[model samples]
Target: MNVSFLRRNRLLAGLFTAVLATGIVAGTAAPASAGNSHHKKIDYVALGDSYAAGQGGGRYLDECLHTKAAYPRAVDKLPGVKLIADATCSGATSLDVLKHQIPRVKHKLQKAELVTLTVGANDIASQEIRETCGAPGAAAPATFDEQRCTTLVLKAIANVKERVLKALVKIDDIRDRVKILVTGYPRLFAAPADAFQARANAAVDGLNAALHQAVKKANMWGVRAYFVDVTRAFHGRLIGDRFPWLHAEGNDTWHPNKWGHLAYSVVVIWHVKRIF
Candidate 1:
């Protein structure tokens, strides 16, 4: 066997062992809300990007677009749930969460019982799909670069994976008293009206896949992170639908509408309840 190959195999084996060990630890560890009662207030924090910030929902709390209609606000209404802080913002990437968003909630995280996050889309430049493949009246790139688009998306996925790992690790550091729930993006369109829409949907799928995998890996490593999929929540309400939940065009193009935010809040609340 090649020495380098042997080293690679050894590394893989070590990682697998570590994952299994963490699984065992997680299985035996005390529940996040072990002694908590219904009467106790649950310190909750929300963090992420436009989706979490409610960019397209309507009235904005600030330039970040954090809105009164955002899911976090809805979550705050739940019994025993207290909104500690919502650090989400429009156009925030994973790195932004690491630097800016996390700091806003870092101290709160140490005492939080629940933390909800919906990041990573901005990390992959989701808007590029609209600018490149889906730009109206603009000629599509040559067939030779079709694969290039795919490669670019793949590279973004890899970068997102690393960033997610780092973010999860940081969250875990302050999550001894918390349960973290990370959300995945919804598919951009239910059915492609044209090649542009098709390509955009595919890109969304890739981004969501990367997020799902990252959450799974984090759980396996005992990071105590869970993925809450919202893809299906917008099943019939994708862009181009008569009553779409997402914006088809405008400054908030591709972002969810108010109805979409309501759906997201419902899904998140359901998951939070299930976890506790």
Candidate 2:
């Protein structure tokens, strides 16, 4: 069996089991009051980590790095849309969102028509992985040890799925009628510039795949969850690209820049129309 393929199957199976354990099933169409109607002002609450907080976009609103140029703010500008709260923070994990961010937005979410979540990257420690695996002159065994990397990536993906499910359950408890868009992270490089870059990009692919599966399971469990793929929106604009929308190499490397945030907003706005 292909090792990568097997890992993906395992990750998806874990997500299915997590959702099944919650005892929720994809049901009939949402109620008319599901908040997609145009007559009502949509209460939007943004949740999750740095990407959702708009860390790299600058113009910080607070320590959380919530920016006026962020996708949520762009979405907020839409007709009949009102941003009730932005509980996103730069270093938030899924557990952090569940513990700290959720409480802050629970009241607002109770009446929210739309909620956008961009999490799970921090849970899997993408930044840390890049730092370790892509560091200059890092030593590796003479013989490739694919199993070691596979094991670590699989475990990380599973943890992300578990935490994401838990967070989704909490959101469901608070607001069952809202449309939840769970966005995935984009590949940092359009093409691997080196061996370490290859490994790092592979890890990102695994993370995105896990997030996609989690969102799918959430929808299966009648949670009204949707995965928004920003990969295509980020095409040809990776870290090494000539006109990169993401930070190249620094403390902020891989985070989307202002143009990237605008692209994210476009993808989100397209999905928002479908939901509302």
Candidate 3:
């Protein structure tokens, strides 16, 4: 009846159809990954922030903002992968992964053959994204009122470096040989719609650079770690695209919609198959 309700219903239906189709493919004919000797499933543990937690996708599984559409669940659907635990939460920072989420999943870490980390955004620029962006998706204000937001976000990233290392080391210590994939964030929009959008996109670039550095540092620490570039997840689908993968309403603004989650899942899955 109402516009919002109608749009909501349409989105939900689309998500349900997509997930169901994915399930069918997984259940009926998912192929084994190349490295697996006999289609042995890789035990995986996913950790990070809202991106990994599957926020703003379809439906919430818990307060952490996990949804069935998250990359971990999607990865699990592959014939050669099995999800052990998803110790991620919405709004989690790198330190939160180190001090809170990781501790709870120690045992899970022990058994995980693969672990993926998608954090650090919250630790650095979340405030600027939320307050400066004046949006729920943790982006710069719609009004672009904060000229200094980008600078602040860039400066804040330095703090997350050590925290990311700590989290990586902790995971490595727990699962000595487990392949660690620290994923980078995608640009929220395909192109810069304006100065604010351009700055916001640049902030994401800064975040990705920080993540890449953290991965390298983790390797120096003797951790079997790698950085995953996820920018391509939104290659042709951005805020102004005809088929944008991210939502644009209420608290979902700028967060990945189901299609965006699917794209993220594909990128992550590709890295897993190639690297792990």
Span of 10 residues, lowest total lDDT, candidate 2: 21-30
lDDT of 1 by residue, 134-203 (tens): 3564455454356666676677778887787778878888777367888888887877888667876776
Compare the candidates by TM-score and give the number of the best one. Answer: 1
* TM-score of candidate 2 versus the correct structure, residues matched by position: 0.79
Instruction: Please tell me which predicted candidate would have the highest lDDT against the true structure.
Output: 3
Given candidate 2, what's the lDDT at residue 52? 83
lDDT of 2 at 55: 80
Per-residue CA lDDT of candidate 3, range 1-276, in tens?
A: 558645744664566455534432342333335234245457889999999999988889899989988989877765566788889899898878888889999999998888999998786556645576554344435466565665567666776777888888889899887889988887876767676677768778888898889889889889988888877656666787666778756776778888778777766776666664
Query: Number of clashes in model 2?
Result: 0
Off by over 4 Å in 2: 1-40, 126-147
Put down candidate 2 lDDT per residue, 3-115, tens digits, no spaces.
Answer: 85456445534543443232111232223443333543678899989898888887778988788768887777665567889888899987788788988879999998788
| lDDT, residue 48, model 1 | 90
- TM-score of decoy 1: 0.80
Model 3, position 42, has a per-residue lDDT of 75
Models 1 onward score TM values of 0.80, 0.79, 0.79
